[model samples]
Target: MSETSPAQRRPSGELEASVLAALWAADGPLSPAEVQSALGGRLARTTVTTILTRLHDKGAASRSRAGRGFAYSPIQDSAGLTARRMRSELDKQDDRNTALARFVSQLTSEDEQLLRTLLDAADDTPQRPGTGPQAAP
Candidate 1:
């Protein structure tokens, strides 16, 4: 079996993610059929609607009345969705040690070193009063 499941392999529900990305990239909400067509015939309008409904249930999409149909848009952008997905994955693994071990084992040498450096830098830096960096004065 592949280490990554299909759920993880794909960015999100293939049709759902694509439709949400399209809506996010667009100026406004899109109808289900419009989203299906935007995906280049890979999925049906009904499937798109199902995906949209699922996203709505998950709080990742919001639907607004548009004529007889509903227009849908993403609640979060691509990066936000990705972070949520990663967090979901990590959350599923209850053991902190196991999670860390899995993450470390997955990283390449360069990435591991980069993580080490970043962790070390964070440890060395002291937090100041304000959120932004201290003034040069």
Candidate 2:
């Protein structure tokens, strides 16, 4: 059997990301066939369906019946998804404060300042009871 070429092989998670991107760009949920077409000819409809199923299983995407096939949509926008992933990684650490400090330390000065500004703004904003990261506990 011939091996797949490097160009044909995708980096791990790239396909799922592509599928999610397509869903995010679309105005509404997309069927597997629609996702495959939106991704061009690189992925098969079955593969798209599998990716959508995996995403749904992980709660990254939501699905509903669209004719005989299912339509899928991203549960969160791209930035929201990335933030959730970051929070998840941070939550997994034994020493979360140290993990966060290290992460903050590595940020560019501009990003650091932006973070500070965002934090300050958050402090001023009226927060609803037991909402947001600060209220997790």
Q: Can you write out model 1's per-residue Cα lDDT over 1-137, one digit (the tens) per residue?
A: 55356777765556666778777877878898888777776676777898888988887889999998899988888889887977888888879788989889999999999989988898688877664346445
Candidate 2: global Cα-lDDT? Answer: 0.89
Q: Say which candidate scores most in TM-score.
A: 2
Q: TM per model?
A: 0.64, 0.87
Candidate 1 — which pairs collide? none
Runs of candidate 2 with Cα error greater than 4 angstroms are 1-8, 131-137
Badly placed stretches (over 4 Å) of model 1 are 1-12, 113-137
- Evaluate residue 117 in candidate 2 and report its C-alpha lDDT on the 0 to 100 scale: 99
